[model samples]
Target: MKMTPHENTKQFPALAPGPPRMFAPQTSTAVSRPKKNSTACLACKAAKRKCSGPDAPCKACRSTNTECHFDPSRDLRRKVAVKRTIQELTNHKDLLESLLSTLGSADQLQFDKVMDLIRKKAPFQDIAHAVGSPATTFGDPQELSNASKLAILEYGENHIETSGNGVRRPSDPGNIASSPEEIPNMKPPQWPTVSPYARVTLESLCDIPLFEVPAKPWTKVTDDDYLVSHLVSLYFTWDHPCTQFLDQRIFLQHMKLGDRRSEFCTPLLVNSLLSMASTYSDSPDVFSTPENVFSRGQNFFHEAQKLWEVEDDDHDLPNIQALLLMCCVFKCQGRVKKSWMMLSQAVRLAQDIGLFDTPAVSKKKMLPEMERVRTITAWGVFNMSSQMSIELQKIAPLEYPTSDVKLCGNEDFDWTPYPRSNKITYDKKPARLPEVREGLAELTRTLVDVQNLVSEKRRGTNLDELWRKAQDPFDRLTAWLQRWPSVPEIQPNPVPQVLLLRIKCLQAIIHLFEILNDPHQPQSVRQARFYQVKSVEETAQCLRIHRQSYGLKHIPSQIVDAIQTGLRILVPQLEESDESRQAFAELCRFGTALSHRFMQTADVIHEIRKNALHLGVRLPPEVIAIFDDPEQWRSLEP
Candidate 1:
């Protein structure tokens, strides 16, 4: 249609081809993101100013004419990498210590040399800084030897003592290093395989019912109601004497098939309950081997502890009870440090709920149905915390000067009143439970006061006041025991309860004379002899009661401690007579029974047998079997 190219060009001779247009892609909205505060350049951060980016000639750096650079912490990859390194090092340190016990002296020396080489050449300085242990404290090889460094790593600062030549010593209770607060602060490391927060949400956990009704079919735990009922009954009966935390009727009602809450059931609560009940439950087949039963979940207590949300459990009773029960499990397992830490938390939690208040104040707020149970739980914690501090020689739970939480009575409802005309003196007829529980509360408080004074390792207080304060509790306890059987609770099955109180009283007496009795003070030797003899008689009586009636329900640390104290006192007297030898033999047998779970007590007995055979006190044959090998304690199960 166009004329020939030339002909067309002639018609529009001045026209020429224009430049071609090209197609371009459109920009995307998908890649857009909100602006974030950029990490400041190191120089800018030092000057307290902002940075545009870590680029060459960044805005601030350009303005200040300084080179732009990133802070070491600003590298996300490095931060995570370093944290993992710290955790790995910490874990390795623990693993090495545990394995060292299995190694021979020669092997240990070889391991020490290897550790020394590693510390000198490895990147420990950087790792130490990363974990918050200052490099200056750990950097120089001369400053800390490999052994010292390992001690610091394994137990943290508070668990070891440093000698002048850089050797390490086990922490002594007399030294301030072994403070009670040490264990409370040391936390087990978290690993990826065990996330306590797994499968459990924190948002509604504390406020929600402890057992939420499942909306679907239940399957995680067994649906065997018979087992559940039996376990529930076992726990209440065994534990109720001490804490009385759960109201049996209310708990049973809540656990009914139609009324049950499943979603709220926590693994630790159920596992701890089962574990504790297994220790006392009558089902022989299920609990034939306690070690097998307790170790079921393989570090279940640790797992349960990980799930304990201390910050959120201020007002939650069930979780608090679970915490206390976990403490019992630890105590039963001879894990003293863990038990004390758990008890500390339980006490603090009780404080948060104002359960430490004296009876007068708590009564004003408590519901009538809940009054007796709550009061008993609070007082139980107080009783436990006070005794633990005494035994451990630590500063105790801080409470209001005056007692506020009330004691429990037989009624399980309110404190029963006495006739106004009746004189409630101890020498008179047996007092009702209200009066007896009051005495028990007083005894606990008084003993705590005695411990604080006697355990004063460094204080320059007068010896006379300490002695007087210590004797006051003994006098009061003696008077209380004289009148104690009048109470209905003590009257029916009084041997076990009386022996418990008597053993505790004996412990206080032993601690008084053995620890704080001044070597040079006038008549100190004579007074100590009297107290020592008294403790021996009491311990024998307590053991006699256990054998005759209750048999034994898991020997407690107090019993172990009392027996050890008797052994210590009797050591000097063994050369004096055959009577002293008889007393010594009895104590050795007790030490054997107690050492079944608590190996430290066995170690004490072994040391006595090893170093003090010249004392002429022969250990029993059964004890010698165990001393030959501590592992044989399992054979003493029956």
Candidate 2:
């Protein structure tokens, strides 16, 4: 029943039979299969369109700015998840509110405190991890006062554990210690004739054989362990100023046991410390039997000297520390030249060991404790150097922080005290002992510059030039005073010798004033006199504090001489009348009494008074009192 081409089309079931019109139906082109969509997104698949638009904003959804690549089904699931999360967050907020309502006020405060501690610890913990530093536990309330900038640095150091190089440095017993034959920058005394006492005193330190200070080996010392313990305790408490780094805990720990490791401390160090202790001890148990105790101290010092001369051990830290401590003993006993000689060697020795390395270089190579210990020890040496320079009327050999070896740690200047660990940890904050010594040393450095300026006669340095040169140092001193703590109980345990620091600062101030050399202007003279009196008052205040805390019996001869020298300068400057004479008389009387208390200092005063008289300076009646009525002065009590 197929229809023909055209004639039979009508006969065949109408037009339905013939082939469909070619144009209307289109030629049966090959069916083009669509390629897979390049952008595979749920949106493109749902719409069944080719998404020509780039990643997120496909052309298919451009009008709505919809995520054309997003899967709607997955989007519904994400929406549900986001809603669930928001609901959970809202529920958590409500729970927090409920907790707040239930918690006590105290608990709330505790929670806040805990949060604060965590906040404080977080950044520091990150830093500690990077630097490989130990972090200090942040719990102390007092530590809060320190400025935040400092807290970051301080916390790391507070927890550091210092390990040693494990090298033991003991001075050989057979080696004789070298004595300083000449002091650099020191001018020999120009005297008409040497005083009997000055000559003898000098000999006692230099001419050891003449004084019969027999060489006693440290092991051969008197076996009175009780006395040694008492003396060592006394030194740590009273005399270890500028020498506090040789750890007392470790030292005592080792002292308690017979098997002390060689790396800890040498016999020379022990003898020197013990010697210094006995020298500074005013306890009746030690001092009542003066000859035996004092002699033993000298003998121990001689043993140290024997060890100090050992060339092989010149690089030893303990030996250097021993020498530094021995200088205090010499100073205590009025052997200043001997002290200067020994201290000069120590300064050189320290420089040799690269103690002056810059902070950046030093930190990378050292563990925490060794760096700190070296710093403190270096400070102690620098302090002694400054003190001696001032005493000798010369410039310090070691410069201040101007060197490449910059001081490090606590840059925020956290003055708050950390817990004392009995032994030294380099990073310990509020290191009061070192700080106090450092204060005086810093002050003394300023004084040294001024003293050197005033003492210079070769270039004929005029007073006007000196005054011009002095303004900066004076400004620095003022700044130091403004920054220094007046009440020095910054650290509570094992009270630092702050009074000693105060005394030194005052002495330095007095020396600064002494350089003015009796200016002609009345206003200038009045101000100078006022400052002189102020300096004396400060000295007296410090001495009073020191006496209350530690008895004056062990007070160094240097202190007595300093006071005497201050009085001597002040007495001549008062109004040239009745009140002036009385003040001068009182000062002379006081100075004489002080000298009598420390007999060795009397000799120093005698030399000073003689020098003053020899220079044709008119002597007052009060000045005549000590020299004319020697017995009268000797009979008086301080």
Best-fitting candidate, scored by TM-score: 1
Candidate 2, residues 1-638, lDDT tens digits: the string is: 86555764353346556776656654554658966444446777677767763466766678667665554323322334334333333333333332343233333543463356456764432222121111212222332323222433433233322137633233343332233254456443342421112222331233111011112223346565545655664565445543454654445555555543444466777778877766543333333222222232665676667866663653367767887888777765555677777788777777767665432233357665455556656766766676667656765646543232234233221221111112123232333654555566567567657656655633687666766777887788768766775634422322335555655666777667666655566665676677767666655555544433333334543465466666566545544555444444544554554443343454445555666667665667656855556446434422
lDDT of candidate 2?
0.52
Candidate 1's C-alpha runs over 4 A off are 1-239, 242-270, 280-303, 310-315, 357-365, 400-407, 412-439, 455-457, 485-495, 519-526, 550-560, 564-584, 600-608, 614-617, 620-638
Please, what are the lDDT tens digits per residue for candidate 1 over residues 1-638?
76884675453444776687786787644656867555667787788876676555678888778877776444333444345345444444533432342233333533464466456764543222122121111223342244345544554534455578855566763554344466567544444432111333232132222123331122124454444445554454334433444544554444444432422234546545655654443233233222222222223344455656432443356566677778877775546788898888877777766676433343355555566556666766777777767767777745642334453445432211111112232122221334434555777777776767755544877776766666767686667656654233443344333455566666766665664567788587678777777677656655654544333333433466677767777766765665666666667666755543343454466457755676666555544664454334323322
The weakest ten consecutive residues by lDDT in model 1 span: 414-423
Q: What TM value does model 1 have?
A: 0.52
- Per-model TM-score, in order, reads 0.52, 0.51
For model 1, which pairs clash?
212-261, 212-262, 212-264, 357-404, 357-405, 358-404, 358-405, 359-404, 430-486
User: At residue 40, what lDDT does model 1 achieve?
Assistant: 65
The per-model lDDT (C-alpha) reads 0.52, 0.52
